[model samples]
Target: MAENEPWQDPRLPEDARLTSLEKRLKQAQLEDAARSGRNDKASHKGRSQGMRILSDLVGIPFGSALIGWLIDGWLGTRPWVMLALLFLGFGIAVRNVLWIARQRPE
Candidate 1:
């Protein structure tokens, strides 16, 4: 063949050539993402789960405490009554956590 002409290697069949080209493109894209430290599906899932658990813990305690404080304050009680109710709220939160844990699949 002429030096300026494109080189066509006859050994590789047409389908094999197309498959190899596609594989290389995918590999290059994955490599670029890895180099950039991007979060893929697995990492995103883990992060989301962690956020959910944190929110659950904080939400349960805060919501219960707020309601307890409101009830105690409306009833004209001081710190002692609110403190007792807060403890009860904590116990309820713990029980809810246990129930949710049990319902989760292994």
Candidate 2:
């Protein structure tokens, strides 16, 4: 053969070349899937954090006061139970906010 006639290495057979190409394709697909999964996980985490913050901001006091009022109304009690539960709920909400803040990435 000529010195520069598109020198072809005969060490690798056609089947070997095809197999190598297939492996490379599989690796590329797996890498893409892993990257996509990471992005999805990050988005899910962010959404969950936002929801937790919103719930803590709105749910605790409302839920506690509502529960207290319902219980008092059913049992014929008055402001005592309502006040206690409202304070309890407020405390719990503050605790949750602190916890969430501490858990955030710096």
Candidate 3:
């Protein structure tokens, strides 16, 4: 148990200890990177999904309503066709959002 008796110790050599520490450090770093990578992927997925939901929710309805308005103008249908088509667009958008949500991975 002498303080300066490391060389005499019947244990791992200094190089072996250093190598073991290096291995542990490398493993820990890899594990940390893997954990952070998973988190990044999860967050990125969530953000992208939110954007997709927003787009599906807004874009489809807007496009449908615009088309409906154009058709109404061309057909001289007043408000009847335009309103019906707008509601149809909204319903389709809702259905799509629900379908997309259901398709998400657990």
Candidate 4:
């Protein structure tokens, strides 16, 4: 009700409220980072590397197996071609994973 009290102003704009919230959220994040003593950049890098490796490990063989199955069906060779392609895919996946693991972290 007082003229000097901005806190009691019911007609404050939405943008002002959003800006205040953003500032407080940023402050809280800074405080949390200070308390945790962890490097977010390093963790993010590690997480990305792990995700890349995982995708390669899963995707390469699965894709190769699917292709091999299709080829076997077309050629009427049953499981032989599929098995060979699957093993080839597995070897390639292992080699890629090993290469990724050996790379120096940037």
Candidate 5:
């Protein structure tokens, strides 16, 4: 682009050439920013999605187990409900993880 500059034309005054160069510089900076902004947006989007998946994978099981334990204590069922719900929660977490993996972008 610099090699193809009209700023080198002999008819153009020095001020005109300077202004053209400044404009080109500003344009180049804007292009750079545009490219970086796209990359940053993609990166942030992927990161946030990963964090959400991680939270779901961890949270659901723990919440399920806690509820199961509380229910068992209230019903005097001891370990049965807790064990069943613990496995159920684990299955749900695995299902969610697999779903997320399957739906990921290529």
Candidate 6:
């Protein structure tokens, strides 16, 4: 209400009641997730798998291109070495993806 004071939302009073309600709600949600077999571990495993795939798809090619660029710069071969390594990196990435696909879920 003051010129410089921060205003609080009336619907969400910061008090003991709100804190207790929040704790209860979180507990209920967690219990529900566990009962439904959709808990954090399952989601985390899915996210981890997705991240691994993403890293393999992007990191390998980019890393290879970077190394090839450096080599090209040193050897004065311009784009030839870089292109070759970039393609090789793509091939490796594909192979890794196939390997991952064949892996049994943990």
Q: Write the per-residue lDDT of candidate 2 for residues 1-106, one digit (tens) a residue.
A: 5322346666644566668889999999889978866545667777788789889978999999999999899888987788899999999998998898777432
* Per-residue C-alpha lDDT of model 1 across residues 37-98, encoded as one tens digit per residue: 66476566656655665666777667767877787788887666667767776777667666
Candidate scoring better on TM-score of 2 and 4 = 4
Indicate the TM-score of model 5: 0.59
lDDT of each: 0.68, 0.80, 0.78, 0.84, 0.81, 0.84
TM-score of 4: 0.63
Best candidate according to TM-score: 4
lDDT for each residue of candidate 5 in 1-106, tens digit (9 for 90 to 100): 5633766777645576668999999999889979866545667667777886898788988998999999999999988998899889989988887787666432
> How many residue pairs clash in each candidate at the backbone level?
0, 0, 0, 0, 0, 0
Q: What is the lDDT of residue 95 in candidate 3?
A: 90
lDDT of 4 at 3: 39
lDDT of 3 by residue, 1-106 (tens): 6433656756644566667889999999889979866555667777777788899889887888888889899999877777887888889989988887776532
Tens digits of per-residue lDDT, candidate 4, 48-103, equal 88998999889988988999999999999989888888889989989998998887
TM-score versus the correct structure, for each prediction: 0.45, 0.53, 0.60, 0.63, 0.59, 0.61
Model 2 stretches with alpha carbons more than 4 Å out: 1-44
Error of 4 at 14 (Å): 20
Candidate 6 on 10-79: residue-level lDDT in tens?
5654678668989999999989987987766667776777788889999999999999999999999999
The segments of candidate 5 whose C-alpha lies over 4 angstroms from its true place after superposition are 1-38
What TM-score would you give candidate 2 relative to the actual structure? 0.53
Worst lDDT run of 10 residues, candidate 5, spans: 3-12
Off by over 4 Å in 6: 1-39
Q: Who is ahead in lDDT, 1 or 2?
A: 2
| Reference-based lDDT, residue 69, model 5 | 97
Off by over 4 Å in 4: 1-38
- Candidate 1, TM-score vs. the true structure? 0.45
Flag regions of model 1 displaced more than 4 Å.
1-39, 88-106
In angstroms, the error of model 4 at 71 is 0.4
